[model samples]
Target: MVEVRMRVNGAVRSLEVEPRVSLLDALRDHLGLTGTKKGCNQGACGACTVLVDGERINSCLALAVQYAGREVVTIEGVAADGQAHPLQEAFIRNDGFQCGYCTSGQICSAIGMLAEHRAGVPSAVTEHLAADVELSAAEIRERMSGNLCRCGAYNGIVESIQDVAS
Candidate 1:
């Protein structure tokens, strides 16, 4: 087992996990952060999405040891002092979920996507590479395509993201 230390939700955590252990397992099993769901257990589904160094990643595809010394944020970390994050509130206000299996991952991915847009990162639908890309529905959908909601809440999800983005 390799000892890995990471800052999760503003708290530093240290745990011993096998090198082959996924970050999702390390967080859920070792650290007891179950908000990040394990869906697909592969990189295709974004159910295990989390923020590492403020960037969204599929926790199931990332090795826990690979994130040593990095800042990792799970769904639990998105809120502050029991108050839900604005995006999370937006999700609720817009009915961004149904079965709720993908809500956490969606919220986390949206958070990171917003950050990327804020930093002027362009999506496939972005028109000009030099200018700040305005987040149209197409852009949002394209950027969030990695995550799939089996409950078919795309409309509400897009609306929630648009609400928060605007």
Candidate 2:
């Protein structure tokens, strides 16, 4: 077992886990943070997405020990003082979910994606990689391509992110 220590949901969390334990399992089975779902245990689905040091990643693909000193932000960590993040509010207002199984991952991914865009990181669909990328429909789609909504709520998800970005 490996000893892992990280800040999760604004609290310092320290635990012993198998070296091979995935971050998703550590969070859900160990820490009781079940909001981050397990969809495709593989990286193909975004259901296990979470933020490590403010960047979104597929928790299923990450080892808990690998994130020992990082700040891990799950869906439960997005709110502050019992108030939802603006993106969370926008998702609700835009009806961005159906079954909601993918909502947590989508929201976490959107939060990181917005941060990347704001930092001038270009997406594959950005016409001019050297130019500032605007948060257009195409841009949003490209940025969120990694997240899949089995409920086919792409339109609403995109709208929600766009709303929050604007």
Q: Which stretches of candidate 1 lie over 4 Å from their true place?
A: 129-133
lDDT of each: 0.93, 0.92
Candidate 1 per-residue C-alpha lDDT over 1-166 given as tens digits, one digit per residue, 9 for 90 to 100: 8999999999999999999999999999999999999999989989999999999999999999999999999999999988989999998999999999999999999999999888778888877554344578888999999999999999999999999888
Q: What's the TM for model 2?
A: 0.96
What TM-score do all the candidates reach, one by one?
A: 0.96, 0.96
Global local distance difference test of model 1: 0.93
How much is 49 displaced in model 1, in angstroms? 0.5
**Which regions of candidate 2 are displaced past 4 Å?**
128-133
